[model samples]
Target: MTASVLSRAGADLSTARESLARAAQRVEDLLGALPVPGLRSLEQRDRAAAAHNEVRAHRVDFMATHATEVYDELTGGRTRDLRLDELVEAAAGAFPGLVPTAGQLAVERSRAQADKEGREIDQGIFLRGVLRCDLAGPHLLTAMLRPTTRALLLLPDFQRTGLIEMEAVRLERRDGVARLTMCRQDCLNAEDERQVDDMETAVDLALLDPAVRVGLIRGGEMTHPRYQGRRVFSAGINLKKLSAGEIPLVGFLLRRELGYLHKIRRGLCPREPEQWHAPYLDKPWVGAIDTFAIGGGTQLALLFDHVIAASDAYFSLPAAREGIIPGVANLRFTRIAGARLSRQVILQGRRILATDPEAHLLVDEVVEPAAMDDAVERALTRLDGAAVVANRRMVNFAEESLADFRAYVGEFTVQQALRIYGEDVIDKVDRFSGRSE
Candidate 1:
């Protein structure tokens, strides 16, 4: 390489090294500044502490490894073949198992990008671009494929009215039940950015509206012959968009964490002094599942307070196949379905049938498809709204607090960002779209 080119490469390496050093210092400062876990919400504090400790360890390894690489390259030694993990491994005896791999650094980078992009997109400019883009094939095949997108673009004035008219989801309130339906029947309720936004809006409305006693989540009736007149809950995140490179993976995952899922976990109310100490939404959520809930669909179902699946309905977490984590599935599923089951489902790509014993453990009730509506109604009616609200607070306080949710999300967000932006995602998306064998 030319001297000028080598000089530029050395400069880039120096910059990367400095960035790692700064990140390590910041993580150390964060650990020092964390509040002590107290009697109330102790589990949350413990989870937070644990998450931060992991971050600290990763940062230490990252900094140490990069510093060595910078020194090696500047000392007239060839550092061309140096791997981040190899450096960390060589120093493992100094800090056992504290070795940061290339993956961890990539994850950290993604986390930074997400933080930056999250703030920039708050004004909805990027979202408008995504919704307006004509690259997605499904949206072209049938204009109905993007009802929410079209409504948002055409009638920006009446967002509420447009949201109500969204063909991807139906937000309805009747007789104290806030019914949030995952529509998009033609695609089996696959979710794109607009659909997720609509769902988040509906969820926020349900949580904020005092009159909404119980929230019911279900899929709209489908007309396709395969699922004619039946509810096909959700196929998952729109792979078509992900494959077409329309939806950037990191932003998509970040939005899910900070948007609908966060809204579902923490209401529109104020949070505690600590950024992580968000208060839980008191309203109970009931999930009415029909044909299938796949990948991200199943992740959403895991968050519901009550789940009623049709006898023929099924659930699957196919993230392993897609080369991504199912957002917070590792944390939530392990708590709900045990670590072993979560591993089998996530790592093995095992499908859990509605009638399976494992499914019963996760789902509260399994009834005939025809009886799903009645089952959901009966389930909702059995619970006294005020009592449900009170009991939810007690249950959340005793078991999973907002702090716990945030800690899991904290780890998930960064880890997901890493996968989303990494080279692995490129190949995964290619395979998913059938561009690769």
Candidate 2:
């Protein structure tokens, strides 16, 4: 009976693979026949869009039905061992025109405008299909928690001197604490590709370091004229770069949530799978919100064990106005703040001042700007005990399980892609930048 069941499963896998391959070929042919987006008539573009949507719906259905089998086939049953980028590269190779190559993504980044005429949107849909798959989505997300190559390369030097300074982030170990500071001075420490890469590398260092018992995130002093010498937590996503099509969909949007942020919340996974349940290489993290935590920055504060905010500091998630999802905030906010307040903040662009009684949901303490340093030290000292790890794990498991996060990302994957390329994105960004007509 077991052999018979196995045989039927194999047959189903084979059928699904064949069906998807034929669908991919049809999509390729249909896209090839359509004129470039700039030259296509409205009716022609509409028809093409409909065809694209139909193919995506079919692909999503297949992925949902045969997720584990298809993913195992793609990864040679080694999905547990592969990194996120490796998995994505494998998918790109298998599907050819359906997914963007690393080089193709780089070319898109160099463009002044996002490619509405190409397969990039289709690629986003394809990725979304994979993420929406229950087992496969969480597996892929877990893969992203592994240490970055940059961090590994710099580990030896850091081990010797306990310091690392990159273009957008700096890290130093002292007194059982790993201090990771965001240093993109020009843009008030806004996150872009460079910032995310450097920050993730810094995060890997903090988690991988043997002597560190606690981690702290704070903004480095800024050089921007408006906030010169002041530490502005983060200005959030670099809208200027975003509007220029410099941020890749996978590299920034998905990578930030599944990569560094997830690592911070869940801790780093081991390179080799463990036979027994082992604690993730995690430590308590504290956020020092000196000036403001806006958008991505606010989303970040949600994951920290404790957050210390300046009395005058503020928090907001303007993702609705910005035409994008506020990185995992949707999944986390309702739990921290009640549903109504979460909606106000995320949907209505409401800002929460640190000193407000309601701000206690996100911030553990609010201190005078001059006393922020002392508040952070107190929080760190309080959290540096041995029991921090176990408590953090328990709270994380109870609040947001890996499965819950996976489901959220599944929806975010496709919805964010659409918003990123939506006509409204550029216009909204332009208005924010004072460049709109």
- Candidate 2 on 1-437: residue-level lDDT in tens? 49999789989867776777677678658877877554677898898788777777766676667667767767677445455556667767765544667776665566644345444565566666667776666667767877888899999999889999999988999998999999889899889999988889999999988888999999999989989889999999998888777766677888888889999999998664661475477889999998899999999999999999999899999988998889889889988999999999999999999988899999988899999888889899999987878888889889898878887887777778778877778678867766555
CA lDDT for candidate 2: 0.81
Q: With candidate 2 superimposed using the best TM-score fit, by how many Å does residue 155's alpha carbon deviate from the native? A: 1.4
Q: Write the per-residue lDDT of candidate 1 for residues 2-56, one digit (tens) a residue.
A: 9998788767655655564565456546534654222224565565556545645
The top-ranked prediction according to lDDT is 2
- Candidate 2, residue 435: Cα displacement in angstroms equals 5.8
lDDT of 2 at 141: 70
Worst ten-residue run, lDDT, model 1?
Answer: 137-146
lDDT of each: 0.60, 0.81
List candidate 2 segments past 4 Å from native.
1-19, 33-35, 96-98, 101-107, 118-124, 128-134, 271-277, 433-437
Query: Distance (Å) between predicted and true CA of 212, model 1?
Result: 0.9
Colliding pairs, model 2: none
Model 1 alpha-carbon miss at residue 329, Å: 1.1
In angstroms, how far off is 77's CA in candidate 2? 1.1
